[model samples]
Every structure is written in C-alpha cells, then in structure tokens.
Target: MERSVIHNLIAALPVAVVAVDHEARVSAANVAASALLGENLTDRPFVTVLRHPVVVQAVDAVLDPAHVSLPVPDPTLAAVGSGGYRNRVIISARGRDIPAEVTVSALPDRIGALVVIEDSSGIEEAEQQRRDFVANVSHELRTPLTAMIGFIETLRGPARDDAAARDRFLSIMETEAARMNRLVMDLLSLSRVESEERRRPAEAVDLTMIIGAVVATLTPHAEAHNVNISLIGAENEALVTGDPDQLTQVFHNLVENAVKYGGSGGEVRLELSRIRHEPALRGPAIAVAVIDRGEGIDEMHLPRLTERFYRVDNHRSRQQGGTGLGLAIVKHIIGRHRGRLRIESVKGQGSRFTVILPAKRDRR
Candidate 1:
C-alpha cells in the first residue's frame, strides 16, 4: 500500500499507531504515535524506536509470512479478531519505560504491519491504588481486633481471679474496641463524601454559626488538653452554599485536630473572613482558617495532608484517636461546595488550614 494511504488510514485512529513497510522500516506514524514514541518516528528503524523482542517478532511475523514466528491463534484475540497479534510490552518512550498493549496486524498483500499501541499507565496505577487501600484497611482493623482478642483471653484465664487486673484489662479492651469503631465510622464517612462529591450542595448554610457551634463542642476537649479554642470574626452571619451537617463535620475535624496535635502552644483559633475575588473560587467567597499556635508541621507533609489515611506521626495519631481520614473528608466536602483548601506551614511557625468556599453557587 502507498505510504500516504497508510498515513491517511492510521491517522483516523484515536490511539497511537505506527506502520512499517515491507522493508521493516517505519513508513508512516500518526500524531498520537509520534507523541507517545517521540519525534521523527517516520522512516526510523522500528526496532530502534521499540526494541522489545516480542514486539519485533510480532512485526516480523506480520511482515513476512515465512518468518519463524508466524501468527498463532490466541483465545484472548477474540476481542481483536484472528487477524491481529496482541502483546503487553514496555516500550521506552522519551527516556521512560511505558507500559502499553500493542496489537500488530498484517496489511493485505504483505505490504507491512500496522502496530496499535494503547497506554496502560493509568489503568495500572488505579489498580495498584485499589490494592493499597484494601491492604491499609485490613491492617487498621486487624491491629485493634488482635489486641482485644488477646486481652479477652487473658481476662478469661489468669486475670479472672484478680479484680484489679480485670478492671484494667476491661478498660484497655474498651479503648481498643472504640478504636475499631472509629476506623469503621471514618471509612463510612469517607465513602459517603466521595459518593456525594460531584453533587453541589444547594442549601445556603450559615458558616459563622457552624464555626461557633464547633468551637463550643470542642472547647471542653481543648481545655482538657490545656488548649484554648476560640472563634474570631464570627460576629456577623456568613452564608455559603453547602450542607450544614458536612460543614459542621469539617470544622469539627479541623478544631479537634488543632486541639489534639497543635495544642502545645495552648491556643487554636478559627479566623473567618470574606474575600471579594478569590482566584481559586472564581468570585467573592468566604474563607474559614483553622490556625494553631503550636509547633508547626514540616513543609513536606502539607501537600499530602488531605490524602486518605495519611498521618505525619502514626503513633501520635493513633494515641490521639485520629483515624487519618478527617482531612480527606474535609477536602471532599469543600470540593462539593466548589471550594478549595489551602495549607500553609513552617517548621516552627505553626500551620494554617484555610477552607475557601464560593459565596454563590454556579447556576450556568
């Protein structure tokens, strides 16, 4: 077939495609293929562009019927049809080894082979993340369950005759049980937030009131930790399009976190204000900042603070009854409101978590 005809044919494809002529040289390549494989793909040696042995053999078989490795029928080829040979191979593209599924098919009359490459990077990454999430949940649940089981066996055996030991064991068991319960609850909340993340909240909720209520609710906990939780700039009503319950949860998590981890400075403050033109929110907005005067977080940890189940200090988080999903849930809630969360911190200057929400909902 003519190189121009081959070019026109494969150019219509949305995926990456490279065509090799009877001489085993690249005859044509689509835009997508050039972008994936790199520049100047046309007329380059196919082996130089993609040096994988399996891919070279597949092209060889398609180009020359008498080649040792002729096409063999694969049950998996039911999707691609009997005319095509498919293989998953890693191809070096722009200095990076990229995972891809390449399908090689012979052109009519032994003209050449048409190779289609499908990038599988995204699919593989998502699968890995799913596996990690399952493993993390299993570990979180197993730790407390195992502790509680050991404690139960002890109380039923040697500790049965000792009242003091029984009381202590029971208390420890209670704490472990609560930990398990909190993990389950946080998982449920995370799931719920993710589910509703695309749905914009329509209710005009009072942000000022919500912050006040959260401050009131966590004041006792703050006092117990020798921390003072205060709400500032809440004298006037601040309304935004959001779910009241979710907003309440967002502030509750932030305030509780400030008290638990940043309470060393003895002061956690919530600062609320109105922004006339917030760049991120695209208009006038309301920003509620949860600030802590305690020892600040490292700059490195700020970027990943909203990642699910990620904690700066695992031991400290567990001891403080943190499930590590609090910030994740807060992020989703703010997203559903078409807002953004900003984290600012220095090694010793404390941290500021600012939640910015657009004052008006987009009706367009």
Candidate 2:
C-alpha cells in the first residue's frame, strides 16, 4: 500500500499505533499514538517516544537484522512472538499512569516495526470492582456467620439445660440467619438490575397507582411506629413507560426506609407532580418524592447513599435489618427507566428522596 494510505489506515485505528524504522526512529505515528505519547514523534527514537523499557526492548527485537532477514510475522497478529517479550506496561499520559497492552509486529518489506498500544483502563476498573465486591460480601457474611456459629455452640453445650437461654439464643440465631438471607437476596436483585439497566422498559405504568399501593402496604408498619404515611399531590393518573414490578420495589424500599428511620418524626409523605424544564430530568417528567420528617442525613453521606453496603450509622442500619443495598437498587431501577434519583436533606430537619420519570407523550 502507499505510505499515505498506510498512515491513513493507522490513524483510523482506535488503539494507538506507531511505525519505526530499522534504527528504531519513529517514521509515522497515528493520532492516538500522538495523543498518548505526545505530538512531534516523527523521526524521534522509539526509546524516547515510548519511554517504557519493555516496549523499547520489544521494538529493538522486532527491528533486529537477524529477524528482519527472516520472513516477517503476520502484522494481523495481536502480539509479537512469545520469547518472554513483555507485552504490557504502564505509561504516563495526561498526568496519570495508564496500563496498556503493547504489541510489536515486524513491518512488511523489513522496513521497521509497528507498535500497537491498547488502553486497558476499563478492564482494570472492572477487575478492581470485582475484587472489592468479593471482599465486601465476605465481610458482611462473616459477621452474621460468626454470631450464628457461636449461638449454635451455646445451645449445644452451655444453654442445653436452660430452656429460657436456649430460646433467646435460638431467636438471635434466627435473626442472624435472616440478615444473611436478606443480604444475599439484595445482592442477587442488584445483579439483575445492573444487567438489565441498558434495556429500556417498554410497558406503560401508572406512577400514581404504584405510589398509592406502596403507601397502603406500608401504612400499618408506619402506624405501629407512630409515623403517618400519606400520598399527596397529583390526584390524577401519572403515566410513564417502565417496569411495574421494579418500580414497586423502588417505592417499597424508599418508604420502608422512611418508616424505619423517620418514624420518630411521625410522618412520611409521598408527593407526586408533573413538571417541565427540570434541570436534571432535562425535559417534561413525572416527579415522585418520598419525603420524611425524621432526623435527616448528613451532607457528606448523601452522595454515597446509593453506594452498595454504604451506611451512615452502621449499628442502626444493622439493627434495622437493612441490607445496605436498598438505595443502590433504587438508583439502578430509576436509571433503567431513563429517569433520575435525587436526594435532598437537611441535618436535623428532614430528607426527601425524589424519583423523576419521563412523561409519556400523548398519542391522541
């Protein structure tokens, strides 16, 4: 191919590519390569442009006269021959170290070598998340598992002859087991929600009805704790496209949380309205706010409320049987519905959790 054509093809590649001559001087560098390694790489030694010792050594091996005389390996292959050639390295870019997969291939006609750099940032992030998730899950499960095992041993030995002690230990054991069960269920639910987040729900749902049902279902629990649950605003039907089951879970979790934590304030309100020109929603939307009158959350904790296993008061959260995945699940469900979830709270005053869904366009 013509030199210009080759350069154009290299420029179009998503990964960074740089071509070097027999002396390891850069002959052509694509746009990605320039952005990563800095511009003005033409005629610059590969060692200076790449900086990484492993990459420079690979380039040297590819340009070696002994290998150049032999038939050049296929350029289509991802990496050069596997003679302990380092194919991965960290490079500094835009003031940050970026992990990249470097592949060196011998150029046809034995002119030089081609260096391909593939950014591995996404892969690294995913791997880190997997590790963190496993660690968090293990820690969460271990606490309850330890308690259950201790109680079992007591019931088998020390508490065996004491009926009252055995009963109490059994009750404690049951609660611990239930907590573990809830945690596993929440984890599974979160996994499912994340997997389906990219697919928009096609079914039309009534926002008002879902809210009313959630309120009615939780009213008794609220009453038991002296909290009055009420649905206010938007008496008319508010329609939107979403998954009804998931929406129900979203409202249920929010209201349950309010009753659990805000019941001391004596009132939990569900407000609905239709609004246009909201900045976050960016269009017409049906807004549902789950407002509580209890002691509100701190400003610092608000941002991380949707994070998995995050809690403001860990002891209180555990006592309340919270899995710490409620808000995370709600956040994902709203996102899947092409909506937004916003939290506004004033310490010692109250907090409001709002869900905004795009309003269904009128077909008539």
Candidate 3:
C-alpha cells in the first residue's frame, strides 16, 4: 500500500495513534493523535507531546533496545507485544491534565514505535466508585458490630447481676441490630436503583398522596422534636409517571431528614408546584419541596452531597440516626424517574430539597 493510503487508514482508526523515529521524534500521527496531541505534532518528541509518564516509559522501553536486550523480561515490553497496555498515567498538554490508558508497540518498519492512547477517565471513575462502595459497606457494618461487642461485654460482666441493667443492654443491642437491618435494606434498594436493567414505563402518580402518607408515618417524630410539619400549596391532583415505591422512598427520605436535622423547635414544610405547561395538560411537573428551618449546608459542600456515603456533619448525622446514604439514594431514585433533584440552602437560614417529576402524559 502507498504511504498516503496507509497514513489515512491509520488516521481513520478510532484510537489515537502516533509514530516516532529512533530519536523519539514524531514522524507521523493519526487523526486521533492529531486531535489529542495537536495537529502540528511532527518532529516533537513523543514524550514531550503526549507528556504522560507511562506513555513515555513505554516509548522509551521500545526505542532503547536495551529493554529488549535485558536478560529478565520486562512486563512493559511484553504488554507492547500483546497490543494491550492499561497503564494509568497523567497527561498534560497546554497546562491541562488528562488521564489516559496507553498502548505502545514496536513498529514493524523500525520507524520508531506506535503509541495508542485511550481516555481512561470513565474507568477510573468506576474504580473510585467501587472503592467508595466497599468502604461505605464496611463502615455501616462496623457500627452494629461495635454496639454488639459493647452490649455483650456488659451482659457478660458488669450487668450480669442487675436484671434491669441487663434488660436495658439487651434492648439497646436489639435497637442496634435493627439499625443494621435497615442499613442493609437501604443498600440493597440503592443497588437495585443503580443496576436496574429494565426501564419501567412511567404513569400518573399522586404526589400529595405519597407525601401525606410519609408525613403521617413521621408525624410522631416531628411532634417529639417539638417541630411543626405542614404541607403548603393547594391539594391538587398532581400526577407524574414513575416507579411508585422509588418515589415514596424519595419523599420518605427527604421528610425524615428534615424531621431529623431541623432544630428542635423548627418547622418543616412540604410544598408542591407545577412548571411549564403542555398540551396533555399533565399539569406543571409535580415538584415537591422539603424545607427545613435548621442549620443549612455550606455552599462548598453542595456539589458532593449526593456522593455515596458523603456526610456534611458526620457526628450530627449519626446522632440523628442518619445512614449517610439517604441523599445518594434519593438522587438515584429521582434520576431513574427521569426527574431532577436539587438542594438549595443558605448557612444559618435553612435548606430546601426539591424533587421535580415529569408530569404524567394524558392518554385522552
């Protein structure tokens, strides 16, 4: 094949490809390479252009010939031969950092070597999520284990002679066990929401009914805290298409959070509104807002609140019996429903959590 044809063909390939000479100067680069390393990459040292330590190492290994001559086989060279390099390295171009997975190989013509680059940001994100998941699970389990150990020790030693003390310890142990059970159930629900393969069609759902049920169930807690819980706006039949259980869980978490964290004498308000009208008259999207008059979240911590196991105030949250997974679960549930979840707060003022569910389509 002609050189131009070969160049075009290589350039057309999806993966970023670059070729360098024995001196490590870029002799040719494909379209992907041009786009990534810049169009004027020729004559630039592959290392200087790509600027990724791992890519540079692989290129240096292939060009040095010493790597091939070494008595002990180098894994990097073997990876080059197999055409599968999964090295994690940072690439900087124009002062911006880029994460990449690089594959390097010795060219047949000895025209230097071929380096293929693939963006690995998504993969790294997945790995980070996995790590967070494991850590959260361990932490959640540790709480129950610690309580169990403390209670068992009291029953076996200090509380053995006192019947009332032993009973109290046993009750506390039971409560801890129940908390662990709830944690497990929430984790399973979160996993299901995250990994659900089938998308269920949405239907008209009454937001008022869901909110009312949640409020009724949590009213005692609100009273116990001396906080007033009230629903705002007219009780209109607002409807949205989405999973009922998930939506219920979303409201339950939001209201429960307000009741738990809002100051002892503060008020919790749940409001509903519609936005942007349509022909089907599904009504404005059913928006439910949970407002709490409590210590609000800081602006800086807003973005990461939905991250799994994230807590704005770990000690306060734990004291209020929060699982730390509540917001994360609420976010995912809203996403599955094709809705938006937002948190607006001002420190020392209060926090408002809004869930906007798409209006149900009128099948008339």
| Candidate No. with top TM-score | 2
Candidates 1 and 2 compared: the better one by lDDT is: 1
TM-score against native, each model = 0.90, 0.90, 0.82
How does model 2 fare in lDDT?
A: 0.86
Query: In candidate 1, what residue range of length 10 has the lowest lDDT sum?
Result: 74-83
User: Which candidate ranks first by lDDT, i.e. highest?
Assistant: 1
RMSD of each candidate relative to the true structure: 2.8, 3.8, 4.0
lDDT of 3 by residue, 1-364 (tens): 3345446767778988887777888877887777777778878877678765556766776777555333234443345354334465677654567677677777665546777778777888899889978988898899778989988988899888999998888888887787788788888888898886257545667887888888898889888888888998737877778777788888988988887876443799999887876333344577789999888889999999998878899887766767778888898888777678889999888899998877876779
lDDT per residue for candidate 1 within 67-97, as digits (tens), equals 4454356333322444558887777888888
* Decreasing lDDT order of the candidates: 1, 2, 3
Off by over 4 Å in 1: 1-13, 68-79, 108-110, 361-364
- For model 3, the superposed segments whose C-alpha errors exceed 4 Å read 1-14, 19-36, 51-75, 80-99, 106-113, 197-200, 263-265, 277-284
Could you give candidate 2's per-residue lDDT for residues 116-153 as a string of tens digits? 88999989999998998899899999999998898888
